[model samples]
Target: MSTGGKVQWINPHMMRAQNFTIRFVKPSRHMPGIVALREIRKYQKSTVTLIQKFPFQRLVKEIAQNLKEEFRFQSSAVDAL
Candidate 1:
């Protein structure tokens, strides 16, 4: 979920499908498309845990390089603010 609010478990089973029921919850916000697709391919794995274990090395390097290059080119003291 988005972590912006809470979900209520009012009606557990909404309707039945081929072999499953369309259960329901609250907060009324739809999940992102990428999240849904990743879940489908995870083989019943927990996306939350996977995201928690994700490495930030690439992201950190990109950010550090950007800062270094910016200062090397045309940086001012105001950039630190």
Candidate 2:
């Protein structure tokens, strides 16, 4: 099930696959793939420059934008206005 905002709650019983209609239980705290990727973007530093390749710059910028959006960070000097 999805809370449909910044959060989601996976049904743990679904993992077992033993019961299709198991009684509904509290949602698990674990995050899904998108959330994990967003979190990585939010906190991790860029290692792309160290790659020493022409393709890496684009990758770095893309990653930076992802990080910025995840944390709602301002991206430009004009953001102050």
Candidate 3:
């Protein structure tokens, strides 16, 4: 043990100072359409319309609605795509 508690001791101040990690993960194949859906949600008539109009619209619509209502969002169907 070289002093810094453990292999994964997260110091909030240090982590903030270091800035967010720059992840290189590739966007899903439907990313562009997903973005488009975000721009269109304000005008969607129904969940069905959202699903029919965008790539992953069902998930995106649910997430957006949850975010609007709860101020937080997370995906449950992680393996669906």
Candidate 4:
């Protein structure tokens, strides 16, 4: 299953020049961490959006956890996404 995320421009001026969204095409069960991290790295260049679509629930949680752990997020900041 493909997870989905919105990649938004961190710079307001650059928003018009680039695509702001990306579909998570990597398989969740087999290599979720790798895919999530890779996507996060890609999005860090921009800004990663939260996944609210029903189909991506599991993948969202996995990615959220990875973000939380990796960034040492202590509150609902990351998970609240």
Return the top candidate by lDDT: 4
- What tens digits encode model 4's per-residue C-alpha lDDT throughout 1-81? 244543332554454467554333433354558878987788788745555545455566577787685534333554565
What digit string (tens of lDDT, one per residue) describes model 1 on residues 1-81?
464666554433444424565544657655679768876878566535433212444444466687786423223322222
Model 3 over residues 1-81: C-alpha lDDT tens digits? 243433444556665678955333332344467868876875675444324434564656688787686544245443243
- CA lDDT of every candidate: 0.50, 0.53, 0.53, 0.55
Clash pairs for candidate 3: none
TM-score of each: 0.20, 0.20, 0.18, 0.20
lDDT for residue 4 in candidate 2, whole number 0-100: 36
Q: Going through the candidates in order, what is the number of backbone clashes in each?
A: 0, 0, 0, 0
Clashes of 2: 0
> How big is the positional error of residue 47 in model 4, measured in Å on the Cα after superposition?
6.1
Q: Model 2, 1-81: lDDT tens per residue?
A: 554344444465784576555353454555568788976896677644335443555555567687685433233522222
Clashes of 3: 0
- How much RMSD separates candidate 3 from the native structure? 20.0
